[model samples]
Target: MPASRDQADRTQRVQLPDETGPVPVSIVHAEPRWFGVPPPLLLFGLAASLFVLALVLLAVGSWPSGLILLGLSALLTAAFLETARRRPGSERMRAAHSWTSSRLELAREHAKRLAEVQGLRGRRAVIESERRS
Candidate 1:
């Protein structure tokens, strides 16, 4: 049988606070790959251009134009990716948002709660007393 909802929620999940330092105040900078997504229009346009080129080459009975188009397409793709990678100050903006957001705040709160539990372990009375305080 499948697991219950509470067990499913608690188990098989990495506690985010545990991954970082004590107090969990450390910045978890998002990975670059997390922000990277291929532009849909770009993919669509490339497919359409390739299809058109293939049709044109077939009609003209020419291998050279097709080969040249392939080479140019490869070159252009490389250039486009390189340009996108630069991204005009995007690195700085990402760095700023990563630490300033609620994500970091929630991580800190989780860390604080985990620390309280760890500090009060092996003594239920102590846990109750600490809670009162």
Candidate 2:
């Protein structure tokens, strides 16, 4: 028996039902199980709020304004300090000093799976867009 044309090509094809057109990109999504808000976002919000308060004081330039800014700044710092009492994530950061984790991992996995998923042969488009950027 003769080998078929597809067998001669040495490549496989798959089909995804919902795909509309070529995507030409890498997409990484978070793990589905965890939905809680990160603590760092809360800390950032507090700092941003304090910065706005300082801006208000800068507009007024009065002694009482200075006092109010100082009081609030102290309070924000103290709140951060209180959270630090748990000594959980901070200790890990201090020990390893590496910041990025799941975000990069997810990006790599998505790139691999996007190429492997049936009918999603958009790897060249993705690579080209990345090169342009």
Give a tens-digit lDDT track for model 2, residues 69-118.
75776565445444433333565533322222244368679988876874
**Best-matching candidate per TM-score:** 2
Q: The CA-based lDDT of model 1 is what?
A: 0.58
Tens digits of per-residue lDDT for model 1 on 13-88? 5656554555536678764552554543353356448747856886788978876776665554444344344442
TM of each candidate vs. truth? 0.27, 0.30
Q: Highest lDDT: which candidate?
A: 1
Q: Residue 29 in model 2: shift from native, Å? A: 26
Angstrom error at residue 42, model 2: 1.6
Give the alpha-carbon lDDT of every model.
0.58, 0.57
Single out the weakest 10-residue window by summed lDDT for candidate 2. Answer: 93-102
Q: Show pairs that collide, candidate 2.
A: 14-118, 14-119
Q: RMSD in angstroms, all models?
A: 33.2, 29.3
